[model samples]
Target: MGKNQSSKIFSPELSCTARIFTLTPHFTQADHAIAGLAINHPQLVATSSARELGRHSDVSEASVIRFVQKLEYESLKDFRDALKKELVNSQTAGNSSVSTQPNTPTEALAQVVALCSQALQMLTTAIDIEELGRAADALEKSTCIHFFAAGGSIRVAQHAAFKLLRLGYPAYAQSEPFSQIAQASIVQSGSVAFGISFTGSTKSVVDALAAAKENGAIVICLTNFAGTQVTELSDIRLITPAPGGILAANSAQTRVAQFAILDALLTLITPRCEYVEK
Candidate 1:
């Protein structure tokens, strides 16, 4: 395995990197160039030619072969076939993560099974063990943490605060709007602030993140959407796959994913600390 393909568990927080890690199970060193190209420019994955993908990723044709080998495919045709399957799996998994009822008994049962399966797939694909280590280290070394979430995001904020506190970290979640601003005002250097939103467009959350940044806190964003406003201000933006279908109400899935990352973070920062009492 290459230096990149270490056996680490990534937090769903490092969405982009985690996705890159998922490709490891399916790609090889030969496919790296094209795969990286496809991921960096998903637009190319659709209509672009292989030569175009090569040029865009700034890698050579030989590198594409190496990438395929890493993925463990025998030939280019095999790799492409598997790649198509992976895409289908990702899309299907996306739809299954959210449970939107179809107004029928049997349909609901099917949806429930699909939803559970999707959650497993998402959580599995989204974790990158090494990058998660980095995030954990950041959380551990920081002296304080300020959290912000609005509307749908508030749940994540609350859950993160709960975990951090239990881990004995100095963490606080902002509730009142002005309280967020006031807390941001006092964030010392070497602190971290988290903002959670699916769309990454919540104004209050954005403003609070800005304040945290101005006060010298490292801003971490938990959002699913790419190219959203909040990512512009965040030091790290963790992306979750958009929950679709009947499971839309299960924001708890997202929250649980966040907690998983927190668990990783806590583990790294305080490896010796006992998580459970005997």
Candidate 2:
């Protein structure tokens, strides 16, 4: 066990897969194999004996025990118990339960599909129909729409903007903070400022939304967490189910949820919005 390793590495906010990825950089070369095995086959890690895991990962029995200890677990049994709990939590949290570890490509796809389905299922309830309707109403009346996002979320922002463009709305997506701030100054009462931040703490999106709000633009936000800076600025907030992450912003499942929200908006606005010159 590494003495320098902190128990704080395991945060409740992070999923089991997130914990493994975050700690992988700090692990020894042999521990890397254990990390992969644990992520793909958590049940095996929970049920297998130390000798069995060692044989499976091509490490010694002592190394297997050391790996568990390094994760701040007191004993192999404690680690196994924690793993069991995580597996159950994942299944309950709409993260899906696939008893068979994904060895084949098809099996791996089943897990992926299951998680995506879970995310979508969570969104059906997470979204407030009234809020969605208000957002659609705002978009229908807007002369223009501005999308604010940063990092990976920028792509999602761009996607939404392009969809609006085809629907005859003058829409633009800005990832660069300064450009967004500058652009926000030009937006007015008939404009829509749509912010995308899964974690809802993105300073770029928050700042843009704030600026647009001050300028009398209808502020809208798409986020996973509620009561965040971006959401606070929004007149219409679209919240989605959070797929836990250490990074916290955009997880794959959360992206699926966000996309579904955007798709729903497009559906609603299509009938309400009148075509304008694009």
Candidate 3:
């Protein structure tokens, strides 16, 4: 594999297993078998041979080979090499490091509060005023606004859309893939499209944003990472730090950060909008 491709496969933003799961709808039986192993026993997949993996996953050795190939690996050896590197990197970064679980509900609630506070603090430290201003400027100038998201992020998109609507902006948030793509395709110049994906890897949101950009709409992305495919298609980016761990992608911390960003952006745009006229 090329250096850049290998780097992406080992990126900390998304584990190899998470990447596979994200694209699981297109997977076959063999792909499912390998992906299952990657998710449940990543260390085993990194250390074991293709034959061993096939046996454990209840698939043929040939199927094992095909599975790696389907993930864009050049060969079984290449896949193992990347897996090993990712495992090492994750270990070094202490991705699995966390305090012991709370023994009681009260303790757990306290821990949750602590984590949320830290996440919001991090958000405040990382936010760039200039970028938020730029985003607000884009929104203020747009004739219409479309919010695109899927899965858990659709809630955030819908919330933002409602806030903008109440402020008299022409805004919409569509959860269905077909409706999102249709709206993106028809958005005219001076329109703004906001794509929300915590991992910034959701194909539907990425494609819809790309479609909007192609049709002359300004595209903005609210994602956890800047280098992801979804961000690549955006004209402006509002980024939040990823909450680390197995449930990182679904963390409430990230959701809180997204809401905070949305609130700030809306506050900035409210003064620019002629809400009284509407």
Candidate 4:
């Protein structure tokens, strides 16, 4: 391809999920299968060979190669190298150290506080201020705003919605699965939907964001990882690094990081409120 054509075809800054989203229109059945593997099982892609990936994704080796090439990789090794780099970055960003056992409550509290502090530091480096500014602008201009979250994340969604409402924005938090989908389906232009998923694999949030995007809403995603299903559906993605492993799952550290993101977003939008400024 010519330089201009290659530039159009390749987006180095896009995550794996975003690449799949861009390629969806041109995908064959086999391509979809390969893309699914790339999006949902990136670890598998990073570790597996093209042939193995094909077998795992239920596609042929040629199909797997074609899929990688379509993503603008010169070869399977190139794709795997990129995926491995991304995985390493995510692992490093979300990595935290906390004592598995503590002799006293003081020790436990100290460990927790240390972990949370580290996670917040990671978040400071992970987030893009420019994208955050854009997200704030989107929320400020939105005629309506909706938050999609499930499980423990529902609390974060509720808090964000409440803050937005306090700022005089039309915002709602949809925690119920049915209600989330219903609201997402009807999201019109001039609306924004925020999906919060730490693991980035929450089916309810992903589905709702996808629906909202299809309905012309600007979908923003708050996720821990880049190459996730929710990120693929989002028009804007805000990532926060938190501790990984069992302790990290629904841990206080993750919640705190999420709250920090919410606070930053709210603070950025606060200036738009005449009453608040006055």
Candidate 5:
């Protein structure tokens, strides 16, 4: 695409989610807060200033400039131009897709397969293998491992802890807010604390990681958003892509992916030992 076209694609008028996806890994704190605000109010974001956007989004002006430059733009002007193009393309794509009821079972199955396949592609694209390896190393070497998560992510945490424990590792799974914090406060250094959150924005989990850090434990995070607050506080962060459109998205599949990752780690860590012993 030409410079002008690219500029229009990333314009400030884009939807918050789109803006986030279009410039992720490259976003600074201010960019994310601004994108989050657009989720609540899109139009006002268009006319907002650095200071105004910062105040409204609760981020700093310096962060706004950092966010822009991170997206590979020469300046905020270039960033805005790129955003415009992204906005235009997204609208164009959405308008062209029409959901139609399938006339046959085979057709419906085909549609399901296509969507899952696409989701798998996105999940793989977002994962960082090196980060996963680091997390595995922490878990393997730790004297004690604590896993904490809430909501949909709790299941992933529980399952991972189970598999790891069965492989002869002492891993605890808890979602209780206070218990998580308490456990983190005491876990010794060289131990591991794993926190799971799809958005990587769960305050309690983040706090728990902080406590674990203060106690000298290595912290690892499994999340769908890279470079989020959770990642910032973690020793290593593993990410996966969101399935998109909250209502249509399948958290189950994401959990399954996280489980698969844990399974792989267990397999690598234990050769003679089985996950379950007689």
Candidate 6:
């Protein structure tokens, strides 16, 4: 069998979502079912024996082993242990959204606030300040900044552009795909192209950033996962924690994390822009 193309080496502190996201739609039906239950309902998998999980997911026991192996886990025991640990950490950190449950409004509010806080706290470790410095350095030299994103991430891109504009960089965001690609096409060495994709797999944003990179613009990506197309195209990668469990990728909590990531980057870029080398 070929090696798993997705990032399978778990970062103990990182949410397992990133690897799973990149391994997607290509997954076998058995694999998909297993992954879904594991994420949104870990109690169904983390504690089950391989055969029990097989019955639970309506697949064969061998299929159960194959699913975990596809994620490149060392063994069923290792996979379950890692999943259990992730669930515990998430619960202890107050990141308590499982995507499979209903909550009262009060409980929901608390859950969201806690999730956002957890995301921010994870950011301190998930992000590499030195790599972030590289992004700031790119912004300092680029004559203009172009932001690219699609769907829910469009708002995030717009927010970033506005922030940079306030900081006095000639920043632009094209909501339309055509305009984005066209703008990227004309960018040259003195430009910066910023991409925002929570899953790090949005095709339009990836295309725009690829064009930007091809044309010599510095490409920087804000994403929740590594080793995705968006990150592959980026010269600088800014990672934030993936908010919530599976199937909640577009939840408002994700935007909170994303917005925080941009604010952090802006904070670093802000001071540099003020000096204005005349």
Pick the TM-score winner. 6
Model 6 lDDT tens row, 172-249: 999999999898999888899999987788888999999889888899998876657887788888766564654457
lDDT of 4 by residue, 177-268 (tens): 99999999889988999999987789999889989888889989887765669877888888765335334658877899899989888988
Q: Over 4 Å off in model 6, which ranges? A: 1-79, 88-103, 243-246, 270-278
RMSD, candidate 5, Å = 6.7
**On residues 118-146, what C-alpha lDDT tens digit does candidate 2 reach at each position?**
66765664567788899999999898999
lDDT of each: 0.62, 0.75, 0.75, 0.77, 0.65, 0.75
lDDT of 3 by residue, 150-249 (tens): 9888999999898888788889999899999998889888899999997778999988998999989998988875456886788887776553533466
Better of 2 and 4 by TM-score: 4
Instruction: Rank candidates by lDDT, best first.
Output: 4, 2, 6, 3, 5, 1
Using lDDT as the yardstick, the better of models 4 and 6 is 4
Error of 4 at 105 (Å): 1.5
The ten-residue window of minimal lDDT in model 5 covers 89-98
Q: Kindly indicate the candidate among 3 and 6 with the higher TM-score.
A: 6
TM-score against truth, every candidate: 0.60, 0.63, 0.63, 0.65, 0.64, 0.68
TM-score of 6: 0.68
With candidate 2 superimposed using the best TM-score fit, by how many Å does residue 140's alpha carbon deviate from the native? 0.2
Of candidates 2 and 1, the better by TM-score: 2
Candidate 4 residue spans exceeding 4 A from truth: 1-99, 245-247, 271-278
Q: What TM-score does candidate 5 reach?
A: 0.64
Local distance difference test, candidate 3: 0.75
| Candidate 2, run of 10 with poorest lDDT | 7-16
**Tens-digit lDDT track for model 1 on 130-233?**
55555676788889888888775676677777767776778899788889888888888899988887667778888989988998988887765545578778
Q: Which stretches of candidate 2 lie over 4 Å from their true place?
A: 1-101, 245-248, 271-278
